[model samples]
Target: MIIANISIPLLGMVDTAVMGHLDSAQYLGAVAVGSIIFSFLFWGFGFLRMATTGLVAQAFGRNDTTLSHTILLQSLVLAIIIASAILILKQPLSQLAFLLIDSSEIVSQQARIYFDIRIWSTPAILINYVFLGWLIGKQASKAALVLVLVVTISNMIMDLVFVNVFGMTIDGVALASLIAEYLGLITGLYLLKRHGVTIKLFKRLSSKQVSLFNWHWLQLHANIFIRTLCLMFSFAFFTTQGAKQGDIILAANAVLLNFITLMAFVLDGFANATEVLSGKAVGAKNRSQLKQSLLLTGLWSFVVASLFSLSYLFFGQQLISLMTSITDVQTTANNYLPWLMLMPVVAVWTYLFDGLFIGTTRSIEMRNTMLLSTLCCFLPAWYFLQPLGNHGLWLALLLFLAARGVSQCFYLPRILRMY
Candidate 1:
């Protein structure tokens, strides 16, 4: 899972590196803004992945193959429905996203180009999410790893070919992603068939079973959707604020955000493990297994996070330079390296707790805690620290992460007691 998760960020780094080397910072800024818009749009429906993993993991724990298959089918149906709606509303959605982001005229124009091409990948990306969640829930890590590798490797290759060989720009990056997502979806379907999850399984599901719009499922997805929205909003807000500072700051911030994302995907490997193990424990009603899984994953998460901080402390500037050649952007990113160094350790807890909550299917707590962190902690800190510039924004983000972990601590006992 760790190997698989790390590949996810490598694609983003490649995109940033490709754009960052360009003569204009607007190119990098465009990718950053465009990526965030998709993050808001697609990740808002992240509940499809989280809910599928939690529910399917529980079914696996109970040794209920029928229920597991049902969950997978339902999730796929939901993904297609949501993706269709997104495609239908793409124009209005694009306009609304650009309206909310205060980027420069040049950056906005390029970002729209990126958005226009990438928006068409909605169905492929959403279905890929369901495939990933289902594979992870079944504890099929090797298959899941293969699916991710296919997407990342193909995307990276296409990114280089389109950008370097064909001399494309942000549009190249967007096209690469669109192609790779469909490739991933195709790979996922093949893997599912190999695991005996076939079209025949869908035929076995009755019309009543196929309909998953009940209160229980809807409530679960709703809470997770809210939680995901809050998470994406925080990142989007960070990008928007940086854009307001000018193109240099926007590009530099984009470079630094790759560090945060790299750290997150690395740590989230442990979180993913925690989700499967903890969800299984809950399904089996095994308190000791749950506690043991949490203890081990949490310990490893902190250790890995510390390694990230140390690496950043020593090699941060070199990383900034490698991502971009622009002197102004490199210097600006270097100035903010300390904040990147601090992020891993501070944010690790949030990832850990999120995994635990998702594994146990505790979406309401996830939603409430994120709301408190974003609304009460992040926004207020940013509002008061406007005088401190970008440093203040980073600080506010750290506070938000800290608030999520701390607030979630209060809910841990209840989870344990329930089991």
Candidate 2:
């Protein structure tokens, strides 16, 4: 699970590393801008994955194959609709996205090229999300790991060929990602068949079943959609503000953000394990197991977080240099390296808590806490501390993360009572 989750960010890191060594910082910044736009766009639909995981894990736990199959179909249906809407609105979405972002003209132009090219992969990307969530929920970690590994490695190879051999630069990375998504979708679909789980989308569900599924599923996912939107917005805001500081700072922050992503996805392995175990416990109505799962996963996540913190503190500069050859960008990234060092330990709790809440399908609480953390905690801090420059941005993000966990803590007492 950890291996699979880590690959998600590593894909972006590869993209960054490829562009980072380019002649100009603008290429890296362009990739950074383009990546975050997709992050905001795609991660907003992460409810497709999270909601599917929660629902399917519970069904799998209860040994209810029908429900499990139905959940996948429902999620994919939602994914297709959302993907089509994104395609339809691609023009205005791009305009509004670039409008909110602050970027140099060259960077903005390059980012648009990347966006225009990659937008075509929308449906494939969303389908991959649903497939990954299904595999994780079914506890098919090995298969999930294989899926991610194939796509990421494929992406890296394509990136090299396109960037180095063909001189495509930013567009090369975007094209690599576009091609990889379709490949991943094909691989994922094959994996589903190999696992011998068949999905029949239009099977005759009772009227009551359809109503219940629609009502509860939509409610759960709507909350998650809003939660994901706010979460992505905070990061997007961070990127936009970083861009305002100039291309070097933007590029440096972009590199540093990858480090944060590294820590998040690494810890998320155990965090996701919690989802499977805890969701199963919820299905079985085993309170003790749920509590135990949370404790074990939380403890293990922190252990990994400790290792990551040390890694960042000790080798951050070397890692920064590996990402970009630009001396100014490397030095700028190093200046803020300490923040990355603190990110793992500081951010671990929110991530751990997220897994717990998500597993038990507490979407409303998840939404509320995230809303408070972002709107109440992060944005205001950034506004007041803007004069301090990037430090303010980093601090606001840290506080935002911390606030998410702390706010969620208050709800835990009530949640535990439910069990």
Candidate 3:
């Protein structure tokens, strides 16, 4: 599961590498802005996958085969519905996102091209999200790994053929991604048939056996919705602020953001593991196992995060240079690299607890705490940094992560005590 999750981001890294070779710095910056916008716009609905996996895993644990199938079906239905909505709103969303990002006109136009082509992949992308979560819930981690690996390899190959061989540029990258996602969705469905289906599971697929409006399921999903929304907005706001500073600043921030994303992808392995184990425990009403999972995952998170921090502390500048060659962007990114180094150390607990909370379907508290913290901690820090220029922006983000970690700490004990 972790390998699967990490592949998604590494594919983005590969895309970055391809774009880095383009003749102009503007292309690199355009992909950065375009990706950040879509990341928030699309993956923000990630709650569907997280919620489904937790619910399905718990249902599986309790031997409630019918409920597990219902969860999977509902997740696909929701993904399709949401993807359609994004399609209708794509133009306005693009306009709004670009307006707020405040990049150079050329970069903005390039981003729009990427956004337009990429928007069509929404349905396939969201369906894959459901498929992935279901696979994880079923403990078919190897299948998930294969699905992502195939998609990543296919995407990289397409990127090379379209961008390098054919000179299709950013649009080529977007098209490559779209093609890869549909291929992945098809692959996922085949895997589901080969590895997931059974006589017992088929019996639960009948319409009469499933409820469309499960209150508990809806409530769990809604909480995650709120949580995901707040999280997306925070990053969106961060990008918008960077954009407002001009392209050099935006490009610098983009380089730094990729590093942050790389760290998140690596740590996500531990968190994704917790999601499976913790959700299964909660589903079985095995409270002790849930507690144990959290403790073990927390220990793992700290160790992994410490290693990441050390890597960044020592080689941050060198890594930033590897991502881009523009002198101004490189210098600006190096200035902000320290924040990325601090991020893993401060936010690892928050990431682990997030998986635990999602698994236990304890999302309302998660949402509420995040909402409050974003307004109280993230906003104030950003507002205070207004006078400090770019340094201030980095400081605000640092505080934002720190605040989330601190808030999670205070709230976690209460939930643990309740368990």
Candidate 4:
């Protein structure tokens, strides 16, 4: 699972590498701004996956197969509706995104190009998120792994063909992503069927099922929606601040941010394991197993995060150079390299608790914890530390991650007590 999950970041890293080597720093900044906008757009609805994982894993544990499918069907329908709305609101979305980012005119235009081409991938992307979560919820990780491999490998090859061979630059990258998502979605649907998930979208709904999905479902997912927004905003703010600094810093911070994301996804494999084990425990009402899974996975996640930090602390410059050939960008990225090295250590806590909370369907706690962290800790720290420039940005992010972990500590006893 970890090997396959590596591809998630590898794809983004490759995108950064491609744009970083371009003649203008604007290419990297454009992709950065464009990606941050989508992160806000797509990740805000990330409840589709997280909520599905919790609900489906619980259903599977209880041997309620029909309920799992109900969750899947409703989530997919919601995903399509959201994606369609995004398509209709693309103009206003782009306008608001550029307004927040305030990039160079050239970078803004290029970002628009990437955004215009890539926005259409939302339906496929969201559907695939549901499929991946469902597979993981059922402990069909090998299948989920296969789907990720398909996405990662296909995206890399396409990126090479479209960008390097065809000279499409940023557009090529966007097009590659568009095609890759559809391919992954097809593969996911096939896998879902093979796993005995009926392909019928129009299932007859029972009143009880409708009631379960209506109020309970909306409540569970709405909290996750707010939590995800807070998390996305921290990084979005980082990129916006970086853009304000200048193109080199923006490009440099963009490249470094990939390192942070790469580590997050890599360690997320352990979190995925936590989701499966913990959700199953919750469903079976096995408190001992839930407690045990949390302890064991927390240890594993921490060890793995430390190993990642060690590697980054030592080889960050070399890795940064691999992404961009521009000497100025390279130099500026190295200045911020220490933060990436420390990121895995500080950020792993958030990832672990996130999986635990999601598995237990504790979305309200997740929302409240992040709300407190983002508004109380992150914003205040960043506001006071703004004079420190990019240093301040990295520090603020570190605090955001740390604050998320720390605030959750106060809630851990209550969480465990309830279970």
Q: What is the number of backbone collisions in each predicted candidate, taken in the order shown? A: 0, 0, 1, 0
lDDT (tens digit, per residue) of candidate 1 on 327-377? 999999999999999899999998998899999999999999999999999
Q: What are the per-model C-alpha RMSD values against the true structure? A: 0.9, 1.6, 1.9, 1.5
Weakest lDDT window of 10 consecutive positions for candidate 3: 198-207
Sort by lDDT, best first: 1, 2, 4, 3
- The per-model lDDT (C-alpha) reads 0.94, 0.90, 0.82, 0.89
Better of 3 and 4 by lDDT: 4
- Backbone clashes counted, model 2: 0
Which has the better lDDT: candidate 2, or candidate 3?
A: 2
* Angstrom error at residue 352, model 2: 0.8
| Regions more than 4 Å wrong, model 2 | 199-213
Candidate 1: lDDT over CA atoms? 0.94
**Off by more than 4 A, model 3:** 198-204
lDDT measured at residue 368 in model 3 versus the true structure, 0 to 100 = 83
Off by over 4 Å in 1: 207-210
Instruction: Return the TM-score for each candidate structure.
Output: 0.99, 0.97, 0.95, 0.97
